[model samples]
Target: MTATQAKPRQPDLKTSLPGPKTAEIMARDQATLSTSYMRPYPFVPDFGKGVWLTDVDGNTMLDFFAGIAVSTTGHAHPHVVQAVQRQIEKFTHVCLTDYPQEITTSLAERLVKHVERPGEKWRVFFSNSGAEAVEAAVKLARNHTGRQHIISTMGSFHGRTYGAITLTGSKTKYKRGFGPLLPAVSHVPYPNPFRPPLGSTPENCGQAVIDHIESLFVGILPADEVAAIIVEPMQGEGGYIVPPADFLPGLRALCDKHGIMLIFDEVQAGMGRTGKMFSFQHFDVQPDIITSAKGIASGMPLGALLAKESVMTWPVGSHGSTYGGNPVAAAASHATLDLLEGQVKHEGCGDSLMDNAAQVGDFILGELKGMQDEFPFIGDVRGRGLFIGIEFVKPDGSPDGALRDQASMMMFEKGLLNLDCGEAVIRISPPLILTREEAATGLDIMRGVFQELK
Candidate 1:
């Protein structure tokens, strides 16, 4: 009856994971699909309605990842579905760059209004994916500041495009064979408190990174020649790491001192994923530009680059994307933003989905911290709202990626969908509409998996 009193749960699965039907489809996929594609688990989805996903094997599972945190309003919410249908009925593509598109223009206005930054004018540029937004950010920062050098944090994931990949400091696999990436990009350590970079303690890691960049200015890269310092306010693929409290603000002050642009790659952490409208809100900082995509349009393909009006100095015909702001995607984004901003409310636990995320996130984080005492492998539990991670560790205190991999697969088999990030962490970024009951369900499965691991 009460939120905390909800019972532990398990999906009444009809078949084993990757049943006959799913296996056959996977075989076909292996033969036909590109070799570069990676399947974390053998979950072949039939359809998803709300927080539940039914696999091709006819087994139902609670979706904990939300298509890697893209379905902001959950899978196929009626509002987003209806918006897409209406836009499709009228027309689909019309290149928002050249034409005057009403849906995109209005959506841009809505985005500007929700920024919550007073007295600062903003501009929006639409793209089809986060990588494109990063590309645009790179160009805009360079063009606006008349500088070429860029700085990014180690273990940050921007995207896979040339500029984005160059900026990305995560796994080398993402950059494998993609030699000759965009030049003049340098990486500095992100101020992760749990495992502080270069043996620095949590309290000083933020300042340490800032000091390193200051040293860079004096020795290698001059401060005046750097265009931007891009970062993920809270990292995504790099194990869902949250930087120190002073990290973002330190970067902001350094950029201000150097006349360098600060870019926040919010592709995974934006769209109300972190309780607030953006992850940057949690910290006392304002970025010169923001790039977002993952959860923007509630499953539709849409990306956005929002910058201060002064930084958006790129002239017309400077850059273009033919299908960036397609009407259908714009419509879906409009509905998604409406729900996020509470213009269209879902009658659930709280005033808005953002409220639900904060409330539920607090509950889950408390539960996870308790689990750490019981589970020796659970070295760390950190998050903002639903953007959570559970790090596994070996006896020697190093990351236990092997055990983390096993736990993720075990959860999937038990009818709970999840994924691993960083070296040994489970990411718990679910849909915004996830209920307390749903949270309990996943938490129960997580408990079982850790118990088994123990």
Candidate 2:
């Protein structure tokens, strides 16, 4: 099948969702699995191919969520699967740090090359997940600057680990009851054009955020003590928020002025999700460090901390991971990158998958905006590339979390897989390889849900 072609057999729902087999598996899952996992609807998957998922009972569903944007090349891309299979057959383990592997080194080289900047050399440190990448970046920033304080934006979701969760400011639930978090971390408001704070306009929101950071420096934290300022180019969990155009550039200037490292947490927005190899590429400014993982290896467990070589001054034993750059995962990553960069193009598809993201994402955004005009609950529609979000709000313009939840569940019941983020925002982060027809199908389901909810 061509990259842009929709599955010939679309969403064949034979039985009610959570059919007999699904119910049986779910019953066993509830008994054995941890309650921490949030399964919004009982759509248990037996297998997936491309943008389609098959439940245990043979019900087919469209996967617009892409496993939370981890499946960059789409589910079970032949290239990635073949690469993993070949690598595993050779040998999967042999901790890279303890015993160097060529595949891991090769993948790191490619990642460094992808982020290369003139007069600035980059190096990659592998980890097992986005949180680990964040942790590594934080440690490296501290070690390089010899400073303790770190800054993150409000409405940001870094990760769930202690240091990562400490940096997250999107929701208190993630931080609640896990207090005494890594100290010296502070959160400043992130610029949101749609719901500007203090009634700031899009033109001034960036400046307002900078002014707030300046105030913090003077009143609370000393600028010299701040080691780094981490942010997402396009906020993900904090509601696929796209900051004002000037926000990132202004933040970069501020970080430079304070001699602070600027870290871009592209775990959710990177790896071709935003029509670029990295989301920060959308802005002219460059960050000192980048944490990437999701979609890096088309759903494989891998994370990377890409940093300027000069800033990664910590000694050898300072950090290491046993499974950070498994050969199998690295092989898969190489294949994933191949498809993303268009080195290996499927028949009749565009040169690169990122190009597809731009085209289809614009189409999806246009449709959502058109729908917003008709639906009062769609208070806002914003995003870049495929990483879009639709905010639900009451008539008074207050966030309507309940309505958002209801709509999301309704979409699931209709055989469309989606996810909610922030307080009342529904995020649409499908695989980068998504086609226009597939996107329209998902949006149609959303429209039906919105109509019913209204």
Candidate 3:
């Protein structure tokens, strides 16, 4: 059923946030779970359905984070669940390297076709996570170009693996203590319309970034040594920053001028997250390689590195994954594509989901913009579709991370689930199937929280 048709339910707090059961579970988690996992608040979920999550205390809270944007079709979507169930009934794993699976081949074919490059042909490599997809893309780029250096934008998050972390420029915290990182990787500024560098206006920030890269080519790094330039069309973990319209096209032109391959790390922004199959579609520029994962399989462990046919020239055994193409995950991905593209017969499904993302996202952005007028703490509001970020700042215009954290905690107490990114920004990335009513409910709760916090 479509999200709109589904029964609308608001937050139902039966007990205080993180009641007895939740607190007990969290205590156990503290004792057993790894300390590395960051828990902003005590939101121990017992179950989730559609855009609503029920914590162990039986409080139903509106889900705006979507498991950090992993649950593309909402929690336990029937189509995805059924597909996985069917696949498991037959066999679970055969190791893609040793045995062939039609489900894997089918998913690859569908992804290539959906990428919509017109005359260009593309190939796919399966992996288990976004980091693995990035690692695969890096390998392909280096192997194809026979070059040693790679360039990435500052404030971009690729992944946490050794190679992927080396390419990531979002935060030093992600790279701290992991010294002697992979060499030959450099970072440049990404165009931020709200805070442009080099005294650049939004209209010219795109060119400013390109100019910096050009300077790099002439000064320290030679263009010939750079194999690839990896970027997020919409920066995610760094902040949901959307560059100027000309930014991506300018990068494409720069890549064409040199022989460097352009790679888009779409792990957080792809698979209809931004009202498009891929975030780059909004810019009308295509990349040589695209890495996808987070929402591709509706919470299943699946990722893919798609590349132009000519760029995927690595020989056999150069790279392979034992559990990359697990049948259940592939099946879940196929089902996800069907739902995302509106192949299902349900009303308000498929392509309508993307449309909803755009419409509802605009509504939320408008509401927040309106709020900014009353509350100067809101520094900026920017995003495309459902992938959005709201920056908080002090009176002097410096980042107000403490205020942001306080607001988030307050919102959590009020039964809204969201997350923070960058220095002081709240990221709102709901599931693709989120309806306008659901979004409005969450926005209303946020409005109340803002009023209280302000």
List model 3 lDDT by residue over 385-414, tens digit each: 899899999999988999999988988888
Best by TM-score: 1
Query: Residue 27 in model 1: shift from native, Å?
Result: 0.5
Task: Output the TM-score of candidate 3.
Answer: 0.96
lDDT for predicted candidate 1 compared with the true structure? 0.90
Alpha carbon lDDT of each predicted model: 0.90, 0.90, 0.89
| Candidate 2 local lDDT, residue 347 | 45
Clash count, one per candidate = 1, 0, 1
Which 10-residue span in candidate 2 carries the lowest summed lDDT?
A: 5-14
| Native-to-model Cα distance after best TM-score fit, residue 256 in candidate 1, in Å | 0.8
| Residue range 1-454, candidate 2, lDDT tens digits | 6999766445788898789999998889988999787768898888988889989899888988998989988888999999999999999899888898999888989999888887889999999899999999999999999999999999999999999999999888887888989999999889998778756887799889988999999999999999999999999999999888888999999999999999999999999888999988998988999999989999889999999998889998889999999888899899999988899995434888888888789999999999987898899998888999999999999999999999998998898888999899999999887888778788888888988987
Report how far residue 48 has shifted in candidate 2, in Å: 0.5
Clash number for candidate 2: 0
CA error at residue 143 for candidate 3, angstroms: 0.6
TM-score, one value per model: 0.97, 0.97, 0.96
